[model samples]
Target: MSDQKPSPLSIGDFATWEPVLRLLWAGSEVHHAGRPARVAGRIGRRSWSLNLRTRLPSPGRAAQVEDIREEVDAVKRVRGALADAGVDDVSFTAEIQPSGEAVLRLLGPSPAVEPGIGTPYPGALILVDGSLPEPWRRLPDPVAGAVPAPSADLKLLERRLREGLPDAVGATEEEITAAEARLGITLPAELKVLYRVTRARWEDYNDDHEAAGRESAAVGCELFDLDALYIADASSRHCRWEFAAMEAVDTPPDAAVQGLVGSPGWIAFGDTGGGDRLAVDLTPGPRGHIGQVIMLSHEESIGAALVADSLTDLVLGRPSTRSSSARGQRPPATAWVTTASLKNVQAAAHPGLEALSIGVWDSAPLSLAPFTGLPRLRTLTAYPGTLADPLEITELPGLEFLQLGPQEWRVLLDARAVPRSLSAAAIVVHGNQDPLPVVALANEILALWDRPRIVQTVLEGAVGPGPGAQPGADRRSGGTPQ
Candidate 1:
């Protein structure tokens, strides 16, 4: 009988999980009908169902390739979740279609859901907070609806932008043609996708890092619009025109920059609200290393900083750190980890240590004590099964945000030693049909969150498929807690 007061979970991670779910549902929602499932402890068989109801376009509206990819990705996530749970006898069937009733049924030795709302079943839920609620569920942004999104071609590219972006729309074939005709140089396919399919502002909101509103991301960096794209020469792309108009700046050594590459012929497209922009190196094909995306900023001495080698890296976002035992580059701000061995991480800890994500998996327990060495770990994501000791969190004093996996969070909360200075927390729940316990936990967290300093909290998971209060915004941004 351990009757100790529980500490709170930390919800301060920067990357989010909305992209997967958004891509999956397209424009549908689940409507639960039966009594919710009961919470089973760390034992017994587990079953869950995702009963999704989608609204097909009225009349002649059509589905696109991104929709198909989203559907497939949804199935992959389901299967991956089951396998990650380490279930011995896993069996489930999914009939997710373009129309009609769509269900994701699972039976496992155990598994993941949407948060706060409760799990669609009695197992785990794989959802995250901090993102604007599904765009379709909220009121349309005044300007978001006004943005032009002409799409006659690039169905796959269009779908991707729509799934992940707030007000994504694609460029017409004519628009793409006109830009290339004006630039004179043949635009790379990936570069065309970057500017044509969506608004490429890549604006970095320096003053408003905490601005989490749906449309706030557009306020900063000046991405090249189609009209700008047509007129700009090699010397003055996007923000470069402004920079080029100024004076000559000193350059730094290559190793210091976060997202730049070698040579000086790169064409700038997007930028940080300040002096840096994401560029494509024209020096590649000539130098036998073409098509790489790097960072070029006037603020720092570092020039040609390497970002990801290609556009695919934007989605996967991994630095080529050579092979095992060698230190790969760390992201300047965040590192999204899906798979990596302990040794690989140990060697790769020097660069981007601000925000790190260790993707959830049902693997053997590992110690977090070692990661305390990550000097700049402001935010860290933890899986319950991965930690051998929850108290290892106490060693770090600078930690600001803590993201916790289901049962493991209970252990941390039970220990009651979470640093009061920790500003935010994210908790993933293994949902059961019963809503009372889940609601009680969220309520309790909300009540106590006002202490030490009001903590930013995000509650999401498949808690209940039906209607419920969704945590509104990341508290750090001054949004009210739901």
Candidate 2:
């Protein structure tokens, strides 16, 4: 793909996808009229599948653009299609004709599922509307008689700002009130005081970079304008289901800051200039003050680091002395069964557990009895043949997302034991397994919810034979293969 953004391709037109389809056909080891060559892959707005194998870069050397330029260009066309369609990602399958004409089909998910993370397939099923992961649903513990830190000196902060920015424009009382109403939460006293001293708007700097730099230096961070102030809640931080489902919230009793994805009390008012957010924490941990300062790191998915005891201390260049670290290992919210990770299912069984993944194991197949009636368990994914009995999944009552092999799914479907509680599902495809059967199984799951089935749009177009187009290797590749 070009570094610069290109115009979106015609999503509904076959010509836009011919190049991509041709590339897939070229790379296929098996392509003939008697056998319909199968190609399956997913493409997202920001990511896509590059199934073609290219030479690995030499040691101590980065890959050159030419290494996978053809693959990147091929996937970029699909990305353009996603943009034109206004969907996050799309999973598709195609079959090549002997004359080089191809039959292409795109997968359309129902409204019941969120867009799958990094895949073209359907994401987590929404059995119930407005359903959220356990971590996102957590609220901070309320503290009685919580007081602001002694370092919170409103007068001193305002005085310092005024002295440093004599010609700066401050926000009016009405502007501050409007911001509070927009956020649906009262601004902390120190934050309000800081805003009153200087609104931190670009207009205040008159588009002068030097003036803006001076204000950032004076305030200790790139402060947001009054109108730009927003509540740092879970909704503000977008996390995909695959990762979000694995996370758990834990706040130690003695800690000074809550361990959460985002909190209602975290009022984002400034930037750390490195993509992280600076917020005034109103919902402080047990030992924390009412209005302490915290920095939400961009690189992390959950929790914030203590920047200072108070906003006043932040401006005054004082490091936070309060200890926010939790002492012991947190309850395992996500578990993996494999030789490299957790060795057994018993070790992972806990009331707090949410997502369980059974990877390639050399030991005997395991049972789901250990997770029976576990209140929080929502996601379960097992490698093919790792489960002793596929019917044992019925014991897990709260499963929302389940990924299992086609054989296991057959057991559940034949026995009429498919869980009614599932919000989303996936088939663990192995080797050169056919996708038609997998799609058939996926339709069965969607049928349970009365959701729309995945529709296949077949398009006929001639693109000639591919480079590696030959017989004998019927390979299937795409998505994060389970």
Best by TM-score: 2
What CA RMSD would candidate 1 show? 20.9
Q: Which ten residues in a row have the lowest lDDT in candidate 1?
A: 132-141
| Tens digit of per-residue lDDT, candidate 2, span 264-362 | 999999998999999999999888888899989898788888889998999888889777756567666789889898999999999988899999988
Where does model 2 exceed 4 Å of error? 1-9, 31-36, 53-82, 114-121, 329-331, 428-433, 465-482
Could you tell me the lDDT of residue 168 within candidate 1?
44
* Candidate 2: C-alpha RMSD after superposition: 5.4
Best by the lDDT measure: 2
Query: What CA RMSD would you report for each candidate?
Result: 20.9, 5.4
Provide TM-scores for the models.
Answer: 0.33, 0.85
What does the lDDT read for residue 436 in candidate 1? 32
Please provide, for model 1 over 182-223, each residue's C-alpha lDDT reduced to its tens digit, 9 standing for 90 to 100: 666666666676655464433433344343232224322345
